[model samples]
Target: MILSTTPTLEGKPIQQYMGIVTAETIIGANVIKDIFAGLRDFFGGRSGTYERVLQEAKDYAMQELMEKARLAGANAVVGVDLDFETIGANGSMLMVIASGTAVRI
Candidate 1:
C-alpha cells in the first residue's frame, strides 16, 4: 500500500474515500533501559534504546493502519498523520498513532 502525508498521490487519482483509518500502539518502557537512558542523559548523547523502541512502535502502528486500509479495499492512504505521546513517570509509557484517509486509486 502507498502511504503519504500529501493530499494526493503523484500519478494516480484517488478513486474512492474509504473513510478514516487509524491505528495506535501503547508501549511500556523497560526499567533497565530507562536506567541506562538516565545515565546517557547525563552524558548528553543519543539513547539508542529509546530510539529503537519508538521506531518499533511507529512501524507497528503504521502496519496496523495499512492493514485497516487493505481491509477496506483501499490501495493507498493519503494525508497520513503520525503522533507520539509519552505517559507515566520516567516516560514509562509511549503511544504512537497513525491516521489517514483510505482510498482506492
Candidate 2:
C-alpha cells in the first residue's frame, strides 16, 4: 500500500476514508548496546548499534501500520506521522508510533 506524509496522494484521488489507523512498537535497550553507546557518547561519535535498533523498530511499526490500514480496507495511508519517545523506568525502552488516515484511492 502507498504511504504518504501528505494529506492527498498525487494523481490518485481518495475514494473513501477508512478512519484512522495506528501502530506502536516498543524496544528495550540491550545492555551491551548501552555500554557501547555510552562509550560513543563519551568519545563523540555515532552509535551504530542504537541506530540499527531504532531503524528496526521504525520498520516494524510502519509494517504494522500498513497491515492495520489493509485490514481497514484501505489501499493507502495518508497524512502519515511517526513519533519516537523514550519510555520505561530510566528510559530503558524506546517507543515508536505510526499513525495515518486509511483511505482507498
Question: How many clashing pairs per prediction, in order?
Answer: 0, 0
Model 1, residue 27: displacement in angstroms? Answer: 0.9
**Residue 60 lDDT in candidate 2:** 96
* Candidate 1 lDDT over residue span 1-105, tens digit each: 999999999989988999899999998888898888999999999999999999999999999999999999999999999999998886689999999999999
Best by lDDT: 2
Q: Which residue pairs does candidate 2 place in steric collision?
A: none
Question: Candidate 2: minimum summed lDDT over ten consecutive residues — where?
Answer: 27-36
The best candidate in terms of TM-score: 2
Off by over 4 Å in 2: none
lDDT of 2 by residue, 1-105 (tens): 999999999899999999999999999998999999999999998999999999999999999999999999999999999999999899999999999999999
For model 2, the local distance difference test gives 0.97
